[model samples]
Target chain A: MRRQITGFSNPTVKHLRSLREKKHRKAAGQFMAEGLRLLTDALACGHVPQVLVMGEQRDPHPLLAKLEAAVERTGGEVIETSEEILSKITGKDNPQGVAGVFAEFDTSLAGIDRSAANIWLVAQALRDPGNLGTMLRTGDAVGAGGLILIDDCADPFSVEAVRASMGAVFTQKVAQASWGEFLPWLRSGAGQLVAASLRDAVPYRGAPYAAPCFVLVGNESRGLPEDYEAACDLRVTMPMKGRADSLNAAVAAAVLAYEVLDKVDS
Target chain B: MRRQITGFSNPTVKHLRSLREKKHRKAAGQFMAEGLRLLTDALACGHVPQVLVMGEQRDPHPLLAKLEAAVERTGGEVIETSEEILSKITGKDNPQGVAGVFAEFDTSLAGIDRSAANIWLVAQALRDPGNLGTMLRTGDAVGAGGLILIDDCADPFSVEAVRASMGAVFTQKVAQASWGEFLPWLRSGAGQLVAASLRDAVPYRGAPYAAPCFVLVGNESRGLPEDYEAACDLRVTMPMKGRADSLNAAVAAAVLAYEVLDKVDS
Candidate 1:
């Protein structure tokens, strides 16, 4: 049996709404995942929610029932609330029926399993939440070990990013570190550092992407700075035939990541 | 000398605002291309703006001066407006210093130079403007001949879509058609049709994308309808190793487009 809450001012609803803000999310050490698909992905990825909220659907869908059972099995509270309250929390006119508040997965640079993982993605100063999420999803798709956010990247836990990530947010490990801290790790001879740059680079397809590789992509606008490019073991460029100078950051990342995967497997 | 307009209620400003709406764009057969880079791309692509608007800058950038010269050379009017007016027209706090109102490039299925082109992109019922723009940019990167928008799709001329295109909108030929009208032409020995589908498909890389190929991508949400899949000469799927069921529409398009380009060139 689940509790029913009709009031919008409920403490749980307030907490869920607060998760929308970065400050609150950081303070509470939790983030909100909306929609049945995201919640199911969260659970499948071994992330148990602290709280699950569902809208008042008179006859609950089978998937909803399964999700509810999974929550209960994990000792998480399940609340059946009015659609209005769910919409309020999600800030959408007609929100998805299911939402979950889950503790953020804590990943550290020291915790990454370098021995077992061959490929990694490093995003520097990425600002767009949607692009960050798309990169996370692409990273997961290519079986990258994890993502490292170097200096002032968009919050991966934000609603826009989480939504854009689909379910990859739960599956991919994400770490935050400054360039100064990350440089030592790259120079530690753990792997090859491949940077995507527009200057003095071999074509991406022609580059020999050795195993245990870390592919570095830069900000959407500025790209990888000169010093950062110099630090990389190899630099690769994608061919551009049109007037536009660059591909979208995430698109470039996907193309590079997939190329690396193809070469590695071959 | 360029005309100086300071009033927000000026007819030119009103007309510029109206271009934001689809109805107005369709009626006028024109769209707004904002930002210096996009305007420059438009001019480089041989698209003469009907009107060019520049925000008041104490010292105009050299690029701005060059753009004004080009517009004047093409017998187009250049207007210098206050930043506030520019900002209001664009709905951005700090709008780019330059914008251009250009007539839409009228492309029809009958007008495409299929004989000279090897690759094309076909988007069916794509709803998101950003994804559409990204696809345009990706298509340009791969040197696709043109893009065909099938059935009901978001207006490619929308500001969001154009901005997302990163100025590729000027270089790429875009045509609109219904599915009923497209199938006959597709089967008229025009080209090979390759559709991306998750069902009964080989890996995308394995697909034999022969020359004069039209790579088809479905909508962001529903994907291609079953009958549409059946209509395709070949169906291909991208390998997804993670929990995500599908890649971002734009990312998927980029990956497939590049793969096609690689095979065609080899």
Candidate 2:
């Protein structure tokens, strides 16, 4: 049933506020996604929003109504609330007047067909949420097979990450695991392994690409974990002659992903 | 004069804390930089720290004595304080036990001989500080003639930018100006102008590099301003085959910079 809750003290608003805190997100098994773009992307990707909340002053954006209809088709609930209530719920400087609570995806790497997929990305210890989000968006653009983040990575579901990702978070398949779990694939010879490093790695442009190869990138402040670097079949470095020795994680991911396609096509 | 400030409540510590506020940063025409790497880079570039603070239990790293000696030589003040005081000044979740205040540099285009410099970067409305900082560091590596920032850019001295730049902020010559002030050179044919855009522009690799050129880039969310786009001698687009239509600002800058050098050296 759709309801218009005007007061900030409303129960629905309170529940939305809880989503910002990590503990609550875990407890609810859901997280809040604000803005029409993200919600639309989530819906288009077969993810259903548990509840769709809209501000009374604003009708759903044209595309948003189609998304809401899709949500209802999935037997989800949609509600309208006051702007004040949304402001209180979002804990954001500017509320987008639309927000949704969606189920947290438990995407895992179990039984994935690596040989068929052209390219995959392996992120090692990337700690910044914004960087991770951007990586996901870039991954979506390149039609990546999937993204596997080794332990000690940022939560891609964080608001900052989601915002920076520009809606790619919803479209990509992401899984987080330890280096131990990833070792079997590295040794499988099913694909090539390229590790981006600061020292002694080949230029990224020239790195060889075999089917099902996974490019591993490290943390922003620190390079990849020692164990992960040792696991790579080949190490590659972006040829940097400028003052900065490294590129932003997302940028590196995009460049390498393009290189993968370039090599495969040629 | 160098001094030892013991308590968190010390007046100097309080003043340092105030500098964390943007208003104070602007009012004093100064900024704060943290971590040993940035401090060392600042000193290396002949940019002296006005005040240096270290944790009580902290011994300067391998470069400390040299840094302190250099500080003394430059007529700068040094202070030793408890870790608690350093924490108060930095307000970072994890304090590195080192912090310093340095006079903001205002490198003008006036003294720089643009024609002789040959290579340069113009960041148009880059909103992310980290992107700008990373671009600066990369610019330094490539030996860019200078960095010119358009309006609405992040303060390169902001803590996040400094951390991401990995100390390139101090080494690079940066000039902040509006399009009107910075574009006269391009108009006068002092140098070629190459603008990065998503408009099916010529591939970066094919772009000509005959003389000094300003590689212009825009904000992460927006491409170059219309007027700026119309002014470019050529609009170059990085070859992107994936779903992502574009690259991160810094990464695009790095690729474009490399492409410029590629054309010149070829």
Candidate 3:
């Protein structure tokens, strides 16, 4: 089905705009991603948007036509929206020409396959959407099975995070759980829980690493709880050679992910 | 001298607010940093603010008092302002209760000591302030001497970059030069220019990373100009095991920085 949304008061426009918020996204079980390139990536990854929104004046592209055909094949709705409406839907002065609305993925621990890859990234209390996105990108780069969000973390499906993920949002498996649930589940699996720490930590480089390693990082300001670090199978520390006390949470994860990949791949 | 700023129309308030924009900041050769901790770190690094603005309701802190004394000793001005004025100056709904305006540092290539550290970070055409900030933090973690901005990049002294840097903006030396100027200067020194590339590139792991390694990252989207990559003394490729074609620019730098650090330190 195809529709045209011309006014701000259109129900579909409101529905699409509401996906920008967490509560609305949760209630509807849907999230929005903008940009033709991003939507094409989603389509390539076997995710057909339930509703595709395109600016009326978007330039013609072969990939965009393929996307339209795929959406039609999947019995999806298509909306031609004005630039002003696109701006309103995205809350950006300069909106991407195309946006896609997809059903939010299964973000439960049960959805994850523990042994799918040699490395997995786990973050706790990560509040920054950009950091969550970066972790997804880092996870994709290292061939990690996915990213496991423990405790209170940013919404992985937020527009900011999705944009920052650079399409890794569709590529990476994202699951959310409380630390309590995560620890017990990890204990039941054949996985190594490792963290960058100072308490009884060996140097990160040349440190003992076991796969499939679950490389973990803590909050931006408070870091991981002492007992959490204590529970890790391995505690490795990266050197802080300057006045800055610690690395950014996502960078720490990237540095650790690469280390684990080097060891496991070798 | 200490004075009270009760209204938004005061020239001092206008001047403080003006520092937030790039043009005004450039004209004044000063930038602002907010919050007590950041200002405290700045003072610790021997960077006394030329202008200190505090909210009238701010809680008394010993460090803040020390900052006031230091600023006064250096013949600087201090302003006690209302929360409304503070909010207007900072453009944040909840003001940090304190903000400091410091003279911009020397950003010329001549100010850097190439022999001071084993690693240095260079970025070309990086547009995100947050990414620029992350590079600074990464450089600090690996004990890099500073960050050199090649070509047109985000303003390193921008408020967003400084905050994201976690005070590394003050810790790390910052220099700005065109690629034309940077190439000749680097050639005159004993430094290794390295980049993450796919052109006859070796795996990043165990690659030959020379001391004073300048780890360079290109734009967020456009990797690097072909000629630029050709000039790299070492071209290392990180394995991309998933659908993501590349890592986030800063994350790529972190992954490579650690690999280079690991090889050099060994």
- Separate DockQ for every predicted complex: 0.78, 0.45, 0.81
Q: Is candidate 1 or candidate 2 better by DockQ?
A: 1
lDDT of 3 by residue, A167-205 (tens): 889988999999899999998889999999878999998
Clash count for each candidate, listed in order shown? 0, 7, 0
On residues A26-133, what C-alpha lDDT tens digit does candidate 1 reach at each position? 999999888887888887788878888888874667767777888899888998898899999988787888888989878677767766666788899999898899
Deviation from truth (RMSD, Å), model 3: 1.7
**Model 3: residues with Cα > 4 Å off, grouped in runs:** none
> What is the per-residue lDDT of model 1 for residues B213-258, given as tens digits with 9 covering 90 to 100?
8989888879899999989888998877777778888898888888
Off by over 4 Å in 1: A8-11, A73-75, B9-11, B73-75
Collision pairs in model 1: none
lDDT per residue for candidate 3 within B213-236, as digits (tens), equals 999999998988999999999999
Cα deviation of B95, candidate 2, in Å: 1.3
* lDDT per residue (tens digit) for residues A1-266 in model 2: 57777777777778889888778887888877888877777777777788888888886367887877877888888888777778878877668988888888785666456764677888888988877877776666566766788877887667777776767777667787777777774566577888877656777665777777787788887878766676677787766654466766766776677667667644
Each candidate's TM vs. the true structure? 0.94, 0.92, 0.96
Candidates, ranked, TM-score? 3, 1, 2
Task: Return the interface RMSD of the candidates, in order shown, one decimal each.
Answer: 0.9, 3.1, 0.9
Name the lDDT value of residue B59 in candidate 2. Answer: 64
Record all residue pairs in model 3 with backbone atoms less than 3 Å apart, i.e. clashing.
Answer: none
Top lDDT hit: 3
Q: TM-score of chain B only, all predictions? A: 0.96, 0.91, 0.97
